[model samples]
Target: PYHSVAACAGLLRAGGFTELADGAQWKLARGGKYFVSKGGSEIMAFIVGGRFCQPGVESGLSIVGAHTDSPCLRLRPNSKVSGAGMLQVGIQTYGGGLWHTWFDRPLGLAGKVVVREAAPGRPDETRLAEKLVRITDPLMILPNLAIHLQSAEERKAFAVNPETHLQPVLCSKMFDDEAGKEASRPEDAGDARHHAALLEVVAKRLGCAPGDIMDADLCLMDSMPACLAGLYEEFISSPRIDNLLSTWAAVQGLCDFAASSAVADCQDVCIAVSFDHEECGSQSTCGADSNSMSVWLESLLGALEVPPLARPLVYAKSFLLSADCAHGVHPNYAAKHQSEHRPDFHKGIVIKTNANQRYATTALTSALFREVCKKADVPVQDFVVRNDSPCGTTIGPIVSSKLGIRTIDIGAPQWAMHSCRETCASSDARHLRALCGAFFESFRNIDTAAAKM
Candidate 1:
């Protein structure tokens, strides 16, 4: 999930959006397409509309927001664990994941790895570099205990203790057999902290000596690629679909808007934000809870030379669609859903609401979004947690409170949400993109239509 920045940044750059460094001064202009990244995981892209900079222009940003991270198992520091001739990797569960789904599944390794650089530089000092590594091959597996091995109570509950049952087997532990296969030199010796077999696999992927891998931040993932499923291929069976679907859809909409002629006459800034750390909490520099967007906005406003007084108006006028995917009503456990507010697959966008402020949606925002969807001819639905159930949250409330941006929580329904593998209606992603793109293209006009209200 942390790999999202590279994919999104590449997409933006390919779409003619210039990348801006956070540390550098920004000189934004009307009708410009640009993006900025922070903490290597969070990204924001924008198309500064032609209508920007007019002294009294009422239009503001049409923004879509989603998160990049999801629930998964992360490799702990010093992850090596061996018993009974098998080497296993110690794992730490991240977020509230369905740990049971992870058992007996093929797992791949991915994330940032720190490697050594040229021994001598500037001051002839040894340097290091971080590289993203993803080994697509099925490198590990957490096999479940067989039915015969389980106690009667365990068989019924199938309760998984993450600490006890989550360790994934990497390979056979033939410690003596590896002695001669490993590099012996001080510089050539790989990170002893990790199992030798694991180091060898990663080093092989990087085409470097195992010892070159100094440190790493890796997680286990389903090695299977996402694919179309169902009799008519109407379902998207995949991993990380919960938020990645929203993240991808938002960026695609932004890029489509940037490419279209609408930007030439558009009256508002069009921005797509994919923040990190939402699954856990958005408190990081890259998270929506922080000043990432504010900092970027301040820089842009300063560069565009908007009047100090009008800056507030521009912010006040902005509307943000918080687009984290919602849960679809389960077929087998349909009773668990709110009877009056069940969201079905492929039923279009779900406008999630909560009385306790779990979501940031308000009556006015919901009305505005509904109007936009209606004009665009897109279907819409609503969802609310059962009174007896606790409502889940998204980046909506955080961004709304922090930036004072008008926000509404929205998502396309999906099933098996935090599982190692998940499912979503294939067409729902298309609808989501269409709705977001329509919102970007039509927000200014919609605002005009509702001016009297």
Candidate 2:
């Protein structure tokens, strides 16, 4: 999540965008590009339209939204536990994840850590710090029980109790001997002391004293880097691909749009945003459901000397594309998807729709997106869950309802969405990027087309 924010900020900086203060107001110039971050997890970068600076000239916004957070095992406070001569880290499943896929997988830690910073004026000064700590060559693993230990019925309906089975082993008795009996202390054998030991490890990783580490929000992630797969290298398998793929594509599209010569001709303000906490019902301050996006847009218009009353007019003309990942039909589980709406890998981007507002894709917005994809020379697919199954949602509905903007839900097709590892076609990723770029570049045209219809 931190990487996505940092990467987008880096791209904006490299593209000559000045980073704006969180709530500070400043006048914007025509074609000026600026970015502001909320809670360091949600970021918005915009390129001003040519006519946006003019008074009484209503310019629309072309926006793309995605989320950074993914389903994973989040380490809790006082999380260390010991049993059967092995030290483990206690974890709570953060979202609806395929818990079984995490078994025996190599895991590493990454997240923000709060610490004390020495300040001259404020003796009680404290600030949060970010760190990615890899404890060992093979940091942790949740080993699966042997198949022979289970009955045929049990094997067929295997279910793990996360509280009992998901604890990741951090160390074993063999490692204690290698450390010269350091784990032999009676106090060290206790849970509290085990937690202290874990803190000490974190301190070492941060090059600070244990007491200096105030708190942390670390999560376990697959240690393996994303890479191309398949004999012909047609697939890209990686952790956090569900939404990161969309996040990456949106960032690339924004950067490309900002750098392109087409900005001068574009009549709509192009904005790209990636929020955190979509996995857990977007209720946080930085989530899509929050007022961050609305506040930023209002602030930008205020800085541009536009009257508060006209802001609603601007928003009414805006269009949003909520980009997330869509489930591709698994060959083995084909019955789970609506037969006519089965999305395929490498086929193109998918336009997601739900009769119930689980997705924000309306007929008008979907048509607009289809036109955008048509112009980009990218094919598009449709997705709808089977009648018996419930559909998972994205930031689409939240943002659309929160801001009252015309929105469409779209994403690249992928398999094993919430698994520790997911797969998507490399070509589909490229196609999505092309589609987003076209969406930003031609959304104004699409809006006009929508009006004519």
After aligning candidate 1 to the native by TM-score, how far in Å is the CA of 40 from where it should be? 1.8
lDDT, candidate 1, 211-245, per-residue tens: 78889889899998999999999999999998999
TM-score of every model? 0.95, 0.92
Taken over the whole model, the C-alpha lDDT of each candidate is 0.87, 0.83
Ten residues in sequence with the least summed lDDT for candidate 1: 180-189
* Tens digits of lDDT, candidate 2, 1-453: 766788789888998888999888777887888889877678888888776635545478889999988999988887868789897888989988999999989887877777665665777785655554554345788899899999998899889888999999888856755774444444534334335556666778888766667677788889888899999999999999988899888878888888888888677789889999999999999998888888888888878777788778788889889999999999999988998999998899999999999999998888888889999999999999888998889898888888888999999999999999999999999998898888888878667656543
Task: Give the CA lDDT, 0 to 100, for residue 294 in model 2.
Answer: 83
User: In model 1, which regions exceed 4 Å deviation?
Assistant: 119-125, 175-190, 451-453
